[model samples]
Each structure stands twice: as C-alpha cells, then as structure tokens.
Target chain A: MKVNEVPQDGNNFKGSDKVKKLVYAVDKDGKYTGVNTKGWEAESFATQQAWAAVEEDLKETEQQVKEGVLSPIAYFMQKCLMDLPLLAKHVGKWQWQVKRHMKPLVFNGLPAKTLQKYADAFEVSVEELKSFGK
Target chain B: MNSTNYQHCQHAHCESGVTSNLLKYAGMDISEPLAFGIGAGIFFGHLPFVKVSGTPGTTFRTWPGTIFKQVTKTLGVKVHTQSFKSVDKAMQALDDVLATGKPVGMLSSVYYLPYLPDAFRFHFNSHNLIAYGKQNGEYLISDPVMEEVSTIKPEDLIKARFAKGFPEPKGFMYYVNEVPPTVDFEYAIKKGIKKTCFMILSPPIPWFGNNAIFLLAKKVKDYPKKLTPRKAALYLGNIIRMQEEIGTGGAGFRFLYAAFLQEAADILQKQELREFAEELTQIGDNWRNFAYSAARLMKDRKSDLVSFDELSDMLYNIGTEEKQFFERLKQVKW
Candidate 1:
C-alpha cells in the first residue's frame, strides 16, 4: 500500500471517537514504512453487524425474563459468556446450584449473601443484577 | 539509553513491532517484518474446544511473548522478563526499570487502555506496548499498534496490566539486558523460515497448523444446520473480526510475512526469495478478498446471505494455497 492511498474517512469508525490503525506503506524507493491509517470501514461494518446480533439475543432474553420464562441469571450468563461451570468457579458455588439459581422462583428465594456472590462474579451490584436491563 | 533515541514506527502487529522497536533502540537495526519473521510469529490454529468469548478461538499468529522471546534468543540478546502478583510491586518494578534508562515492554489488556477508540476496545489480554518514561502520574506509552505515542494514567495502566481473564497478564514486563555487537542475519532468517514451515506443515493435531484451517472450514459448513441464524452470523462475524480487525495489519498477517520475506531476500541476496515474497503478496491479497466477501455477507442480512458452504469452500481454498506455499518455502535454500 502507498502512503497516499491510506484511508482518510474517519467517519466509518463506529462510536463517537475515531480509531486509527498503523498500516504498512511503500515509498518511492520501495522501502516499507508504517503509516497511520484512519477508518476501517469493513471492520466497523462487521462489528456493527455482530453487535446487532447480540442485541437481538438480549431482546429475546429480556422478553423471556419479563414473562417469568427465565431468570436474570440466564441473561447475564449469556451476556458475560460464562457457562455454568465458569460462573460456578467465579462464585465458588457448585455447577448444579448455579443451574438451579437460573430459575426465577429459586433465585428470588435466595439470601442476600448468595445474591451478592452472583453480583460480584458478574462485576455488578446486587440491585443491578436483580433488575438487569430494566 | 536516551529516551529521545527511541523512535516509534507503526507496524501491522503489536508484539513484533515492539520487538523491532526495542531492538532499534538497543542499537540493533531491525525492521518489524524481520523481527516478526526471525521471531517466527506467523502461525494458525483453530481450537474449537477452546472457547473465547462464546466462540471457538481462531488465531493467525503465535501466542503473545513468543515473538520477543524467540527473536532475542535467536539474535544472542539477553532479556529480563517478570510477572508480578501485586499491582503496587509491578508498578514499582516498572518504574525502577525505567529509572535505569531502559524502556520496559509490557503485556496489557486492550479494554482498559484509554487511547484506543471505544469501538476497538475488547477484553484481549495479550496486547503489547512499551513504557518509555514517566512524567507526573502518567506513563509514556509506545503502543506499536497506534500511530502516535500516548500516555496512560498510572491507575489505568495498572488496571490494564492486571486485567482478569484467560491468559491474565499478571503485570508481565520484559526488557533487553544485553545486545550483542553484531548479529548473524543470514542464519536467523533461514532458521525462522524453516521453523515457520515446519510448525505449519507438521502439527500433529487436527486443530492446529494447516489442518486447523480445514477443521474450521468443516465446522463452518455445519454451523448453518447446527446453530441458529443469529448464532451463525455472530460466529462468522467473529472470524472476520479476528482476521481483519484486530492487529492483523490486514489479510491475517500474510502481508507482514511477505514483507519479511522481501527483507530476507535483500539480506541474503536471494532472487528466488524475492520472487517468493511477491507470490506471498498475491496470496495475502487473496486472503483480503475472502475477508471482503465474508464482511459483505455479514452486512447484508436482508437479502439471501452468502451460504456457509461458500464460506467454508473459501477457507478450504486458502488452507490449500497456504499449505502449498509453506511446503515450497521450506525447501528454498538460504
């Protein structure tokens, strides 16, 4: 790639702030040098698409929670990419107990100590975890 | 070592760029590609069993620290590396190292770094950068993946260094302790190429080297039937992001390797290696084409998206092409 050809359209970068990548460029002497290339249209586009897919899943999870079909734990576990075993490890709980806590009735009956454990594992406050995305 | 003597040059990959820049600062003239090639940085692996962020992990380069370790060892340089359990201790150690006029190389998480754009922030823990100096409460950072030098608050720097996740950095840091007066570039170049070829061609498991490419292709083909539409799209999107978005320089580090071969050709005066470099450049372009197609499919959700079969076929073709290239590369006499 040539220095003159570096992408300058920073608008394609998602979020309010602009992102730049260090790109390799060839000069008149065929020598390679690093140049700051701004705006990754393809990367931003793919990421947006991926995040949209994630949002769709989140919406479905919210609906399920609202309907009492599942508990907030299920939504958070999915969002954090933590399986039962992983979340269990973080919270120092058995996998079976973690799975049981996914039920709305069971989770609601849990003590504040258990709720604190789940909240700490997810890096959220107890209140936040109890009413996630509300 | 004068802090002013350290010149930061941007590169496609971070670790290799940091290694190259450190070498240059230590009075050894080395290019990023040369550092990458001699470091044996190019690699591939797709471990479906090892999940990263809910998706199978696909890597285009060797794990972090390999490049710097391998390159310095190959060039007869002495380096000191350490990881700390305590954040305060790590900060003190880093400051002490900088106080000696030597810049410290550090492993950090990208998510906590404030300089990177919000869109690019992820929980990747293996990102490499250099701490050249300190002023007030800030650490002057020479992040190879960025264009300009940036500074990080001490609190943020410590947080990045101690980011909790898989492959936790644990405040890992390294710096060169000794540099030889001269290096045997010819020998290092040949060794690097041979190692890369052998690793890619000869990994025993199906989930590694050239085999992993085919393995991933097969899994992708099954994804449409095995996964929901949304899950399938997310999987495809992650693959593209890993290949094109993060630190690949573009085309999954193929172009960087080609640049290394070009440099090797100049160093050894090998016409065949130059030709091979040009051929590799075309292969890199082919990889870019694949990313473009995959991205297009990902973005076009309304229309009939590109079939998983088509995407799988594209990966298979790339794997085959890469296999042949490395096989020939291994045979070239340096």
Candidate 2:
C-alpha cells in the first residue's frame, strides 16, 4: 500500500488515544517508508469479534456461576482469559485439582489459603473472587 | 553500558524491532525489515489441531526468538542470554543488568502490560520489549510496537514475564554483548532469502508452509457445512486478526519482506531483486484483497456456502501464487 493510501480509518487502537502502530508502506517515490497508523477497518472488526466471543463465554460462565453449577473460580478464570490448564499451571496445582475447585461445593469447603492461591493467580483479592455472581 | 545511545524505533513486529534496535545500539545499522528478512521471520502456518482462543491456530511468522537467535548468530554477534525459574532471581538479574547501564531484551505477555490500550491487550505470551533501566521503581520499556519509550511497574513487568501459557516467557532475557564493526550484508541477505524460500517451500506437511494455506482453504470451504455460522465467521475473523491486526507490518510480513527485498536490491544493486520486490508488493496487495473480501463475508454472515466457496478459492489462489513466488525467488542468480 502507498503511504497516502494506508488505511487510517482508525479503531482508536482499542480505545487508547496514545499509541499508534507502525506500518510499512511505499511513498509517492515508490520507496518503502514506515508510517504510523491508528488502526484499520479489517483489523478492528476481527478484534471486536474475538472479544465478542470472549464476552459471550463470560456471560455463559456468569449464568453457570449464578446457578451454582460452577464456582466463582470458573468465573474469574474466564475473566482472566485463562483456560483450566493455564490457571492450574499458574496456581501450581494439577489440572484435576483445579477442576475440582471449580465445583461450588468443593470451592466452598476450600480453606482461605487455597482461595488465596487462586486469587493471587488471577490477580484478584480473595474477597472479590468469593463475591462473584452475588 | 549506558542506554543513552539507544534509539527506539517502533516496528511492525516486536522481535524484529528489538533485534534491529539492539543491533543499532551495537553500532550496526539494521532496519526492522532487514532484520526480519535476515532473520527469516516471515512464515505461514495454520494448524487445525492447535487451538488459540477456540479457533484453529494461524501464525504468519516463525516461532518467537528465532529471529533474534538466527540474526545474531549469522552476524557473529555475541549475546548474553538466560532464563530463570525463580521470579525474584529474574527480577534481580534484570535490575543488576540495568544497574550496569546495559539494556536487556526480554519476552512478555501483552495482557499484563497496562501501558497498552485495553483494545489491544490479550493473553499473548511472546511479546518482546527492552528494559533499559529502572526509574523510581518502574522499569523503563522500549516496546517495539509502541511509538516511544514507556515505563512499566515492577509488578506488572513481573506478571508479563511470568504469564502462564504456551511459549511461557519464564523470565527469558538477553542482551547483545558484542557486534562486529564490519559485516557482510550481501551474504546475510542471500542467506535470509534462501532460508525463507526453503521454509515456505520445503515443509513436507500440510500443516505448515505453503501447504498449510491450502489446508486452511479446505477448512474454510467446509466451515459453513461443518460449523455454525458464527463459528465459521469467527474462524475466518481469526485469520484476519492474525494476518492484519497482530502487526505483521501489513499483509502478514509480505510488505515487510518486500521492503527488505527493496533494500537488499539497493545494497546489492540487483535490478532483478528490485523487480522481484515490485512483484511481491503486488502479491501483498492481493493478500490485502483477500482480507478485505473475507472481512466482508464475515461482516454480512448472510452469505451461503457458495460465498464460502469463493473465499476459499481466493485463499487457494494466494497459496498457489505464493508457492510459485518463493520458487522463483529461490532461483535468483545472486
């Protein structure tokens, strides 16, 4: 793409006013030049769609949490964009142990230290995590 | 050891920019595109079995750290590299290096970096940046995708470096120790181009290289038949995001590579490579056209399997033409 033609239809770069990504385009002289673009239409759509999918999952997880079918750990895990394997690894527990913690009954009987581990992994407070879907 | 001499150039890709910036600081003049090309960073992979964010994995470049390793090795630059199992030790090591006034490049996760806008943050674990020094407890950052130097708090930096996932950073860090004053660009460029050609054309499986493009095309062709419309659109949108949104410098590094060929042509004075550069630019445009068409289909979501047929056809042509492009590049006389 030419420099002038480089699409600047900008997405506000995910709502940040400050950062602009660099794009390599040709100038009028047909020489390659580095130009900063706020964003482009195609990119913005893709990002939105991905985030939308995540949001949808979040909603479903929220519904499950409300029904007590899953524990708050599941909600926070999805909120953090982490899968069970990742959250388990981060918390230094086996996947099955982490999966067990996602059960509301199992999560409720967990000790404070256990809750703290999951909260720390998600970068949230224990209280905030426990308060999910309330 | 002081980083006062360091010049930060925001680049299309993080590792390539970090590679270029580090080389420039070492007193060698290397642009981002040149570093990317010399590092053989451009690539194509669409793995059906591997899932990223619930969509099939699609990568437009070589694995992370390959560019830095290959480019430095090829140029005989000495580097200090290490990975840490202990987070405290890692942060301490970073501080110790910064204390000596040397800048260090390291892997990070975009999700933990708050300096970036919310729109761009994700759980991507292989983002790269440079830590020049510590100031009032915040680490100075020279992220390649950002326009200028920024700072990150120690806690956030720690989280970024330690983000748990595939390709985990594990607090991996490196810095250039020495760079030769005089180097051979002609040889490096030729090697870079050759490596790229081999990477694209020599992979034996359909999950990688040019063959992967056709593999994904086949998948796209079946998306409407096999998956929900939303799912199909998500799969295609993920492709665009990987190709255009995630900073391949446009057209999944096609434009960046073209820029490198143009620069290489100037250095080697190869009129033939210049012609190849122009041709690749057109090819890059075709890739953009593919993205535009795909995005339109994704937006409408009303089109039938026939539209899917056309989209897959466009991608099939891209794969075929790209295969031919590399083959011809492999035959370049110099």
What fraction of the genuine interface contacts, i.e. the true contacts, does candidate 1 reproduce? Answer: 0.42
The window of 10 residues in a row where model 1 chain B has the poorest summed lDDT is: B298-307
What would the per-residue lDDT of candidate 2 be over residues B205-300, giving only the tens digit for each residue? 999899999998899999989999899989988999899888788998889999999999999999888788888888888888888888888889
- Which digits, one per residue and each the tens of the lDDT, describe model 1 over residues B1-334? 2266668777778899899988888889999899999999898899888877667888899878899998999899999999999999999999898988898899998878988876667678899999998977788999988778899999899878987667889999999988999899999999999889988999999987989999988998998799876677777778878887787776778878888988999899998887787677667767666776777776674445666788889899999989999999998865
List where candidate 1 sits over 4 angstroms from the true fold. Answer: A1-9, A12-17, A25-33, A60-134, B1-5, B302-306
Clashing pairs in 2: A14-B119
Model 2 Cα lDDT, one tens digit per residue, A1-134: 88987887765645754677888898988899899887778878888888898899999999999999999999989888888888888889999999999999999999999999999988889999998887
Position B90, candidate 1: lDDT: 98
True contacts kept of 2: 0.74
CA-only RMSD, every prediction: 3.2, 1.5
lDDT per residue as tens, model 1, A14-121: 452344676655566655566666655666666777666656777898888888878898888766545666677667788899888988989889999999988876
TM-score for chain B considered on its own, for each of the candidates:
0.97, 0.97
C-alpha displacement of A20 in model 1, angstroms?
Answer: 1.6
